[model samples]
Target: MHAGGIGAPTIARTLNEEGIPNPTSYAKLTGYSWHNRPSSSLWSAGCIYSILHNETYLGTLCQGRQLTPEGQFHSKKNIPKDQWVRTVGHHPAIIDDELLRRELKARKEAGAHNLHEQKKNFPPGIFGKEVRCASCGKILTKGKTLRKTGCERTLFCPTRKKSPSHCKGAFISEKHLESAILHELKNLADRYSDDRVQIGICQDAQSADLIQEKNRLKTAVELIEKEITAYEQRSRDLYLKRATDGMSIDDFNSALSRIRNDVDKLRLKSKRASSELLHLNESIAAESIRMETVLKAADFNHLDKTKVSMLIESVYVHKRDPKSGTQAIDITWKF
Candidate 1:
């Protein structure tokens, strides 16, 4: 009604006049729980806004929205957007899709009455913050390029619009950028998995070397601990021999002093070795997870938000080549 001609107050008054139940009143009559008092069941602008934004009426049902740990329903848990399951066409639609779209558009215009409006003609692409200009170090915003063939998706450096002299008009086609990124990702995955690759460039080889180093350090630590134990036993034996008069007191004291010094040295070596081993192990684990993530990303056929966020840190777009008519893109991996 707000999108049509009626205002919020008029809509509320019409609902009350027609004896139609508001949300809380309807929910209460339908056996649903409403914590509010019965006196506050009248419709208002806030209620209208909530109804307009709710996805349930658009033939979609969203589940797993609440993270109810320990079965506490009242506690508000901030669940990530990705974790929510949305099932489209799971229920009957109360409104047509076109009407819903118009209402949404209207609401957006109303909300942005005093704010900067977003560009609406952007084609489908997944390069959010990942794409940037190499010359100016600013994000490349998406726009369309009109060519003799047709319209092609393009990205431009925002700084070029303000200070053209600062940047040499950094721009590139989305198709070329995506192809470069996908090629680089696939190359990385292949390099890690190929046994013929050099150890310096191979992720698997680095991981293996880290594991071997960690194991060697662990073994060294164990040897040092055994030596410390042996020294402690020898000191005990020296004390027993002194009591039995098998050796002189001065000789026993000298042996005990040497054994104690050896034990101290071995303890220090063991501490250092253990610390190094712990750090090496952590590095190995992190590298393994990173490799797994990259390999999983290589399975994607096209770019998406998830894949871009997981695989790419940033893409530097160099100036286009005049002869080859292709821009050089340097992709920095997240790992």
Candidate 2:
């Protein structure tokens, strides 16, 4: 339950990234204005199923469990949360203790936590990391506007209070910003049709042919092994000299421990590199193909929002680009 705990919007975003299929539940992305789903036991049951089976709330990684023959379990088992092995520090978890408890409470009372009254009211465009309030240095938030005037994206000072200080609550009209963004975005869309972007990535991928890539990886592994062997020999020589000369065991042991730790790290890195290389070599052609596909698509629609979302990390608006009036959109995507 760090900023926004696992919620309906989280479910939608996860599906979008993983290519899972689900019928729309909200009228818009990151919106609570429900799409007015057809009321039926079937819908209610699905909601119940989604709540019960979802793994996000538990902070546990999941893989579909499989069974084996000889009456033995395969690589999968639904172990308890306490026993599940976790990869520490891999990624931020969506859920924590408090949200998990509250979610169960809400589900027991209502059908799902979603039906519970929202705790934090926010503005719509403020849903993502996009809106910045020029005043508070905080991203503007989304919420329902008073007088039922539809969603308003706004900036506010939470330090003052939860209630909106509409007096100081300055907002960028989303329509106007989207208009400005689109005006610049059109060129990005035009860049979609540019072939050179695709060509550059394709050329890079092609430069490292699959067989050559595998060989290079193997060579790197061999070099790491050579370094490890050399280090071990050096440590051994130090130990023998110290033994023959009656050197201080404390100093000798300290040096030996440091050397051993280095060796251990080196071995681990070597193994990791080797494993990574094996996977990459296997998928070299496939990844190259995927890159080619993305390149072609990027060339086709350089500025599509969805495509832009994948490739671009940030777009810096520049005064020079605006002044020029030609190539006014100064843009950079991982291109």
Candidate 3:
């Protein structure tokens, strides 16, 4: 094969059948563990790429650090192999570790792709949909730092932010936002778990009230219709009296007009009340479903993409600990 030729990803089923490693720790260390349903090609390919480029593959690198566009972007001139901190020959090899390290070095020098990069979905944030820079119409992105410091992701268009000069959208890290949301969730969970907690969410009480209101509205609508019917009858009687010469034309016309206005008012009120009642009923039903979700939410440890989309409004990742070195994701509830 030529040096620049693209390598096709091995089919997932074939990779598993041949006892190649995957993302699962057992698979990565042992070989072919996920039996009933193996990791799909997408996930397996990701794993293969990570393993190949991992400086740790040769036991030569641990936590290989590189600068990002969002971090102190590094240049090729300053980085070296020894300072990279290698721990060679620790694990069994599937590919040539030396080749991987070389490629890794080259790629790192080029400023693209990483384990963390894998976490971000390509094509960037939901910008054209969610928020815009108002100025440049370009999407704002996460912050830049002198070193590997955590910054929130911002939403602004590239043209606006980078600018031939239209918008330098104020950027914020999604990370910080995410952390706040996570803290809120954890706090809420703890509060619910407390044995001595006295507070009630009042959902049941609220539901009862909603039901009562709906009934009241129905009754009110009936009364309104009765009033409207009375007014309608009065209008007809006045018109008939004038036509039969029982009342003056002026008096008949005035009385009929007044009665018609009353009937119209009553009808409008009845319609509004009916709509409100319907909405109240719908709200109660929705709340019931929401409470059920809350009750069952404890079962989930990790939220998959689909679930997160349905249940969460947005996710924010923020505030990296310099010491601990782990990223946190904060998810906002849809509510």
Indicate which candidate wins on lDDT. Answer: 1
lDDT order, best first, reads: 1, 3, 2
Q: Write the per-residue lDDT of candidate 1 for residues 160-217, one digit (tens) a residue.
A: 6444444676888888788888787788778666764343333466666887898899
lDDT of each: 0.76, 0.51, 0.53
Q: What is the TM-score of each candidate against the true structure?
A: 0.56, 0.26, 0.41
Order of the predicted models by TM-score, top scorer first: 1, 3, 2
* Candidate 1 similarity to native, TM-score: 0.56
The sequence of per-residue lDDT tens digits that candidate 3 reaches over residues 1-335 is: 11133331334334554555446746535655656574332224345566665555555535334434555557524345546655566665555766665655675664466535645633233222232244433334533333355433344233332222333334444444334444565555554454432233323455668878988999999999889888877777777778787787788778877887888888889999999988987887676555545545544544434544556764433334569965444444664
lDDT of 1 at 151: 72
Worst lDDT window (10 residues) for model 3? Answer: 1-10
Better of 2 and 3 by TM-score: 3
Off by over 4 Å in 1: 1-124, 195-208, 246-254, 323-326
- Candidate 2 ranges with C-alpha deviation above 4 Å: 1-213, 285-335
For model 3, the stretches where C-alpha displacement exceeds 4 angstroms are 1-203, 317-330
Which run of 10 residues does model 2 get worst, by summed lDDT? 158-167
Write candidate 2's Cα lDDT for 92-191 as tens digits: 5555646666766665676445334443454224123433443343444443334467555433332112223211333434443444554554554454
